[model samples]
Target: MEMVQMLRENATLLKLGYQFELPGPRMAATGILTRNQDQQRQKRMQERKAEEVVEQKSATSSNQEVPTRKIAEMVKHQEVCNKAQIRKPKTKKLKNGANEKESEDILKDLRNNLKPSVKSRHEASNLPPPQRSGRDDLMAAIRGSSIFSLKRVNLT
Candidate 1:
């Protein structure tokens, strides 16, 4: 029993090849360095295992806490409040070759004419082909029927 107690007490000193009261500071430093290295290795192994577990969790994200937001709660589109821009009419006068005037009636008449008109079934059939104004107005493209297929027949 006495021998076992002595051995247990001197275990660290014995491992460092020391005799009688732990030799010098150099030997003690060597032992400490080796122990520190072992601890560092264990720490590195634990970090590697932790990284692997995190990778697995990320790979299976569906079952885990999915960072989600309800699509319905989000505003899909916001109403665009366009600033009213009153464009100057290209024609400086009325259709009757009148002088330039900034009357409200003239402006209102011009605005009404500029707006696109949706033709009904009967109106579309009777609508005449729009004149190619060479401008980019959408109304210029609205034609009743295509004139390409209409060939003039001479009944002579």
Candidate 2:
């Protein structure tokens, strides 16, 4: 009686309609709650097993339809290709026309300078070529055979 009075003092248990029943033949009715919980758990397990078996059957059926599946994949690929844009390849022209005159003059001067020296093997020496300052003006002066022309020749 004291335990029942103590339990009844709890506002939460009273709100949830909890009954403080004594241990006796009356307690046999509580076995229904345990049986209900077990039944719900068993139902959920059977549902999960059924779902897995259904998925396995669908997978096996899809494998059997392999030819149709390939045709569907090819159709999807064609749709993707059609949605994309086809572009023309880019091309560039290589022209050396502008420097033709300058190159020809340089070639003529180099030929004139090398020919006479090649004929006379006594002029050949194992000395390094002379370095030049003021690159543009000096290179033009040497090519034109102007001032300091012999000292400024470009060696190969």
Candidate 3:
């Protein structure tokens, strides 16, 4: 009887060891699920904020009669803002070596000064393309980097 009991215990330990050696997803917990949900929530929030800015710009434009000169300025401002926002990440590679914080400040200022809009007839006639892909802007960033500058000297 004692021998049978010892064999049963050994079998149970071997089964547990084999199970532990099996490879599978280790994060079988609620933490990963909550983290993913949080990321999705933040993404939704950013999209909503961008939409709100567009709506506000449209509302203001419709309620007020902006002169052609002002409209032109707004369009120019919007274009500049769009460009800055697009190039924000690449600012670090600039010849002057602007830091991340400065680029972020510039972006904040641009966003504060101008908002994007939905094209009404007047805006449709005047407006340029709303946004371009990152690939389209990559060459521009590379050309503007210090690597392309013949006049730049490395102090190091």
Report, for all candidates in order, the number of backbone clashes: 0, 0, 0
Q: Rate the local accuracy (lDDT) of all candidates.
A: 0.58, 0.64, 0.64
Tens digits of per-residue lDDT for model 2 on 1-156? 554444334423312245646664224334444455566778899999999999999999988967987889999998888666354345443356546677778889998987867536655555566776698777777688856436656889
Residue pairs in collision within model 2:
none
- Residue-wise lDDT of candidate 1 within 35-71, one digit each (tens)? 6567677889999999999988888885556434544
Worst 10 residues of 3 by lDDT: 11-20
lDDT of 1: 0.58
Clashing pairs in 1: none
Residues 36-107, candidate 3: write the lDDT tens digits: 566677889999999999999999989788578989999999999999899877533744788778888988
Q: Candidate 3 — which residues are off by over 4 angstroms?
A: 1-28, 66-156
Candidates sorted by TM-score, best first? 2, 3, 1
